[model samples]
Target: MAIPSKTIKVFEELLESPQNRLVEQAVESGRIPIGYSCSFVPEALLMADKLFPLRLHAPGLAGTELADNYLSCFVCSYTRGLLEFAMDGRYDLLKGWVFVPSCAHMQRLYDNLEYLQKPDFNHILDVPRKVNNDTLLWMTEELQMLADKLAHHFGADMSDVSLRKAMEQWNDFASVVQSIGDLRKKPNPPINGAEFHQIVMASLASPKDLILPYILDFKKEIEQREGIKNSRARLMLVGGHLHDPEFIRVIESQGCVVVADRFCTGTIPGFKTIDINNDSPYKILAEYTFAKTLCPRMMEDFDRRLNTIIDTVKEYNADGVVLEIIKFCDLWGVDAMPLVSALRDNGIPVLRLEREYCLGGEGQLRTRVQAFIESMGK
Candidate 1:
């Protein structure tokens, strides 16, 4: 299915442009632009502060020599790119930085930012490495502290009324992504794999207020259109630190329809929401985020994470699954083989690809994905 020009334009301006339209629009409107590294940073909290919760990304970064001065070359390329951008004055527009943990590189990135050049505001959030009732209490305390810090730092609204309103808007944002994501499950999805991925990338790259209504409108467009997809097999993508359009395009170019995905950048924690009915939204946010985030950083949680992949395979009716991993990214790296084995054990074909942090490695990936799809012979 061809993407609507209007929707395509939305991403082209955000993803392909030299400057971030969302950040530009936020700055021009006199709103604070708060950049964050991990999904654990609550958008609802940022929106409550009237700040644009810009998910920090190093789109189209050419090289990482500058960052290599401070970070070892062994780190994930995505982290290297982020540090390079920061040192090169790329994040000068951001007023604050919020970092949460799932990997060691990000933790060091915050330290490097503090040493080289620090933003006006800096916050490091703590999430438990385990899942239990005690985790809820710990996260509650941490979120409450974060709320207080943000209120003091930005001098913006943190009232119950403001918090509730932010949750409503965030829930609406989730609804729009969920509606579009649901389309991928159709036997002949109305949207192509790369097209839907662009939609997901646009959500993180742009302001939620602008992207929300735009996608809600686009949802109606896809609903009324007829799909024309005839692929060799159904594929599901699962991994981390991936936002490259070429990654999916190359796979699709090989006669595979990417039916579903689970990743930090794609959709996992990104699709989830807290209980808005709770009187204390902070506690709700803490509990929901702690429970739902299934990164490999959370040790001994492999069963839950594997179950999620299996469930996605079943739910999307995927014929095979691909796990995309960035080399040396300890967070997802360790799980690649286990996931491949577990999924294959369940009678699902699995392919694991170790890729670059950026878009340079698609030639090799295309060959493998093509072979994988051809083997299915659907």
Candidate 2:
């Protein structure tokens, strides 16, 4: 079954909401909302505890005057952007936030957020650097403590069964999205690349149950429409947060299919799942959180991330790589030179575009992307 046309329309509409209403609803109903950075956070488990786990993304702020007052110029641009947004009261809706020790810059941001004169519920979660058994035990204990704090604040009790059920539902949802991603690798994929991005972005904001069916239906629909022509050149998108479907649409409109991506808000973050074997739910969540791959901002080793992108592009038979760098994203900007060089050494052409999270930049991006696709054809 494919997602109904009406459902897609509704998903688009929800994205337009100035404040994340879904998050607002979760908080208003006496549920704690914990914002997290990196893919390691087991947000699903938090949801099971009746807490909304929102991924803390870079806020795409216009100025950094406020952030500069607290942080140094050497800090990563994403951290600065987030600080600017917080200062501007953009994410005032969040009840609390969780920050992992992903990088030195991120850790600094956490310190500032914790001590700064702002909202009362903001917090910094200390995550262990290593992934050993000792660390896992420590993390489990930490998560349990955090859970207790949330329960006390929200006046709600979270049972083991509920947490397990939420994990199961999220696992199912992940499987469905993985299936759709797998389909994109086919010579004649069922759904268009742009449409697939829309589905994925929508899933982030919607409930698991609602998202799972739409994904399954979309897969089935694509299967039915097999044998459709696929003249567009295949490409892999790499860079900062790309949660907006409009970005994908811009690339697709330029006659290129985004076969894979390693963006902060794309497949990299959503690809992993929690292990169900652990008897201790907190332990399971801890292991999942700490063992995941680090993003550009989190890890010093750029080569590992570059190699992963190369592998993904190879697996998908992508003809070129598009680095969708967001302007002022220090991590991506720093990594771009080496990443592009590595891909070029492997005989893959790359195009890098610096953009803000808006639609106006599409006109210039489309021309450059179209030229890249045209070059791939030759």
Candidate 3:
């Protein structure tokens, strides 16, 4: 499934023009529009119902004032930026919003949008924590309930055939993404970290049909390029909102390849797939919510998180870890010391970089990352 070059060009163009008009067209054409926070939401069901499932990225408007009313002054910049975008009516095209209870801040944001601001259609999906039979049954029911709601709201019945079709399409997208991830496992990965980040970000922002082809093409491009002759130290990136290509570029150029990660924008979203056959989607969601690897702000499981990191480092044979702490992101920042301690205990070095979701600090960040990588050589 090599993606074509033409497909890559089209995807790039679509990203450049992420306008309301495009989303509006999808809605006006009788497709229901739904927005989701995390990538765990199943796109197949949405497609089956003739709806547009859009991953909410930037709201396209400033959220400073709106966010100030709800969140604290020291919250993650990504949260504030998104709130500002929503406040400015950039998400006017959204008929419904799906909030996967990943973090407290995101849950709070969902509450505000659904209850306070009042979007046309709103649903808070409760993701389960642990993966088990009980959780699967519960999740299936939740998906059905969501399907029923959409059927009623859109004045269309959701058929079994459509559901199955949607499931297949969603699965196809997942498979493509998984292939991309597998590529990273290779010793001389054809794709660079920055390019890979861009591809993933593009997939998040657009539909699978639009992004899949581009990814395939990008994979082909990588295969054609000369592979890395000397392997660099492997590093696992941990943090939230790492959609910036420049951040990846800075880190990769410092002689370290990000082989694995647990970031909000990275592995976390792809780790779980929605089981549409659950007896209760809400309960399944709830289980995922509770079982999810809690961040510093969410739970007091630093040891557990540390163990998870250690396991990933060992699994990926990583030489070190990089924690991209968003500036003033209380959760990650607060957990920094313990996370560092845990990594050090396992004889794996770690690097902490604070960022504001901008490229302005790249020069200094690169220097620090280079130093970290240099130490790995010794």
Best by lDDT: 1
TM-score of each: 0.96, 0.80, 0.79
Prediction-by-prediction clash tally: 0, 3, 31
Candidates, ranked, TM-score: 1, 2, 3
| Residues 167-255 of candidate 3: C-alpha lDDT, one tens digit per residue | 66766776676666766767776555555666666666665554566677766666675544465677788886676666776787766
Model 3 scores a C-alpha lDDT of: 0.66
Clashing pairs in 2: 1-217, 2-217, 2-218
What is the alpha-carbon lDDT of model 1 when measured against the actual structure?
0.80
lDDT of 1 at 83: 92
Off by over 4 Å in 2: 1-6, 18-30, 56-93, 101-117, 128-142, 156-162, 210-223, 298-303
In the range 65-169, model 2's lDDT, one tens digit per residue, is 899899887665567767877777767777777676756777788888876745555545566655577877988887887767666766546567777877787
